[model samples]
Target: MSISSSGFSWPLRVYYEDTDVSGVVYHANYLKFFERARTEWLRSLGYSQESLRHEVEVAFTVSRVEVAFRSPARLDDQLIATVAVTELKRASLVMTQQLRLGDIDGRLLAEAEVKVVSVDAASFKPCALPDGFRNRVQTVENAASRNPSSSAA
Candidate 1:
């Protein structure tokens, strides 16, 4: 997770179905938001679950997750999911994800440290990240690398 790219920033609007009777977004829904951000981030990286299988011969699966709830999101509240790669390994990547509430961005609604493991598509077993992909992600950490600005999550 050493590489940090403004990876993706996706806006999410709270809806009625995402909340409970109290009109506050449910905690579990934060995971859904994180998942969407990660999926899109991967897509932006020119990788997709299906394409990764057919082309790269690999797919990613959740290996670990640790989340902390900080606040509640209310219905109609516009939120932002910011994702960044914080660590990387031969066969896994660690991501730091945050769900910020509204424009104020005062308090985090939720935060997660997620670990994704690369696996061989055919065996569905752990595998090292392909050289091409690994090198591309590593370039972000280079001293002369051009950092991409905040992205649409």
Candidate 2:
């Protein structure tokens, strides 16, 4: 399987618990996969959700999501969830994610545009992203540029 050059990719396997009775991955499970990828992306940059909340007193919450299911994934399928930062603002970020069949030449299965907002961990109110956090993201973006791939249709 080819790696996504435009973003971080997290590999996953469709397990029985992730599928419906018909053996197809349940639609809601795609959200979980996407979440995991995003979390891993943060970890790759030396951050964790907990650390962001505790150390920086900031947390990220999903503000919006727009998803399109182009195909279904069945049980035992190898999937790759790709996460890319499309836009970054003071208090929010727009990310594009894709779920693809990893072993099948990255055939697209589902895609989503997600907006995540930075907030005060205790108050849960909108807050500016930390400067270091933004810098790290910029670093990742720069690295991804070397092997850029379109996240758009």
Candidate 3:
């Protein structure tokens, strides 16, 4: 995994389980890749879902997802999944995520806009995200704005 001013990136290999009989990745599996990238993005800022649930009683849930499949990835292919916060609100944040082949700047296989909400872990009611978490993401965005070269798709 790598962190940059643009966003958080996680490296992954396309396993047999992620692909179809034809060896191309399943459409639904793109969502899983995006989800993992977001989880790691949170971890990069020192927040884990487990810790958040235990300490703050909050967990993130995907409220909406819009995905565009540009190309196909085959089994055993190396990929990079990226997560960048595009918008933030009191209880929800929109992340722009992408799946690329081989490296961060490689061929774009898929891209998605995912809206995630902070919710009460047990009750599953919407809740505001912690100030620290919001601030950390904002800091990253600020840096990205200053250095546009590391832009994420």
Candidate 4:
């Protein structure tokens, strides 16, 4: 994992199960990779999705996503998925994620802009994020701002 002014990056290796018969990554699998990166980003901020639901009665659900595939990644390829918060609203967050080859200067494979809403665990109704969670997000946002080179996808 690597953290930059741009966002949180999680390393991934394309596996056999992640590929198609031709060994190219299946299109839908990119969503799974991006989702994992987002979850890990939340974990890095000292919050776990399961714990949030159990303790705070809150959970995040994807509300919208727009993805563009630039290239196909093959099985065994080293990859990095980066998640950056582009907007933080009371009940939702908009993020941009990029999947790239793990090289000196990563090669872009796919990019997506996703929106996720915080909702009541039981009711599944939109809800404002907890104060502490908001603060954590702000902290990361502030840090990213300090590193101007970190650009969103």
How much is the lDDT of residue 44 in candidate 2? Answer: 88
Q: What local lDDT does model 4 show for residue 5?
A: 51
Model 4 worst lDDT window (10 residues): 1-10
Cα error of candidate 2 at position 17, Å = 0.5
Error of 1 at 143 (Å): 8.3
Task: Pick out the ten consecutive residues of candidate 2 with the lowest summed lDDT.
Answer: 144-153
> Predicted candidate 2: what Cα RMSD to the true structure?
4.8
lDDT values for all models: 0.81, 0.87, 0.85, 0.88
lDDT of 3 by residue, 63-152 (tens): 999999999999999999988777888998888888999755599999998899999999999999888888888887778767866544
Best of the candidates, lDDT: 4
C-alpha TM-score for every candidate: 0.86, 0.91, 0.90, 0.92
Candidate 4 per-residue lDDT over residues 43-135, each given as its tens digit: 888899999999999999999999999999999999999988888888888988999999786889999999999999999999999999988
Clashing pairs in 4: none
lDDT by residue (87-153, candidate 2, tens digit) is 8888988889999998847899999999999999999999999999998887767667674652212
lDDT of 4: 0.88
User: Where in model 1 is the C-alpha error above 4 Å?
Assistant: 4-7, 140-153
| TM-score of model 4 (CA atoms) | 0.92
Which pairs clash in the backbone of model 2? none
lDDT per residue as tens, model 1, 88-147: 899999988988875874468899999999999999899999988888666643322245
**Model 2 TM-score?**
0.91
